[model samples]
Target: MRTFRLYGGFLGAAEVMTKPVGLTAAWWQVLGAVLREPLPVSGIAREMSLTRQSVQRIADLLVERGLAEYLPNPAHKRAKLLRPTGEGYSAVRRLTAAQHAFTNRVSSRVDVDELRTTLAVMERLIAALDEEGL
Candidate 1:
């Protein structure tokens, strides 16, 4: 229950943080996923644990807004890779300072060791769930 509440809080924070950049939390999430490398909407959906159709809709909106662009995928002809445009990258980058400050403030209130242990436990839980196909 605490974890669920924490997740909701984080999403709310993300929405607030992204609003000034003209993005919603969902758009920020999808854009952040492809910052390192381009991927198809299905790929993003899989990584983000969202439906392909939902991701497709968001991807289309991003492209339409000139925040992202589609590129040819050498591996899959039909599945175009979605890459962030200059404006997209800039928008995400703009969040960096606020994100860093937020993290710093949060970390300051938590014990480092406790945080590490909690993170480790969370990772283990994720791994266990993945292994179980849950």
Candidate 2:
């Protein structure tokens, strides 16, 4: 309940934050997943907990818009790695700035200790769920 609400609110915020860069929340998510390193659509889907088909669709759109590109994967010939182009990097950087400001503003109203505790609990919950395959 609370967790779902928080996720919904975060998604809404992401949508607004990504709009200036001509990206939707889903597009930003796909781009962000590969920002650190290129990954196949399957890898992105696993990391994001989204369906592979959905990630594939977003990846295609990003490539079509010139925000990202596909590169050969030595590990898997058919599963080419997806990476962001220079323009994509620029957009992500802008989003990083905005996210930092947003975080700072939100943090100002919350107790640091409470935030830390909540994060720890959430991490534990996630780990438990993963272990249980729930």
Candidate 3:
């Protein structure tokens, strides 16, 4: 219950922070997932732990909004690679800056080593849950 509440809080905060960049939390998530390189919707979905159908819809919307584009995939005939557009990069930059500012503010009041330990614990919990197929 506490974990759910914490996640909810993060989502609410993300929505507010990402709005100025003309993005929703979902859109920001999609853009962030593809930051390193172009990927098929399925790949994006896998990496982000989201459903492929939902990602497809978001990818289509991003293309319509001129934030992402579909390029021919040499590896797969039907699966086009979704690449971020210039606008997408700009939006990501803004989102990153906002994230950095928030992190900086929080870091000043938190212990960095404790934060690392908390992250490790969370990762271990997730791994354990995954092993149980939860």
lDDT of each: 0.93, 0.93, 0.91
Model 3: which ten-residue window has the lowest total lDDT? 125-134
TM-score of each: 0.94, 0.94, 0.90
lDDT of 1 by residue, 1-134 (tens): 99899999889888888888999889999999899999999999988878999999999999999999999999999999999999999999999887788789878999999999989998999889879865
**Model 1, CA-based lDDT:** 0.93
lDDT-wise, the better of 1 and 2 is 2
By TM-score, highest first, what's the ranking?
1, 2, 3
Which candidate number has the best TM-score?
1
As a whole number from 0 to 100, the lDDT of residue 46 in candidate 2 is 85
Per-residue error (Å), model 1, residue 29: 0.7
**Poorly placed runs, candidate 1 (over 4 Å):** none
Cα deviation of 134 in candidate 3 (Å)?
6.0
| lDDT rank order | 2, 1, 3
Write one digit per residue (lDDT tens) for candidate 2, span 1-134: 99799899989989889998799999999999999999999999988878999999999999999999999999999999999999999988889888888789878999999999999998998899779865
Q: By how many angstroms RMSD does model 3 differ from the true structure?
A: 1.6
Give residue 15's lDDT in candidate 1 (0 to 100). 86
Summarize candidate 3's per-residue lDDT along 1-134 as a digit string, tens digits.
99899889889989989999899999999988888999999999987778999999999999999999999999999999999999999998988778888778867787989899989998998889778865
Window of ten residues with lowest summed lDDT in model 1: 125-134
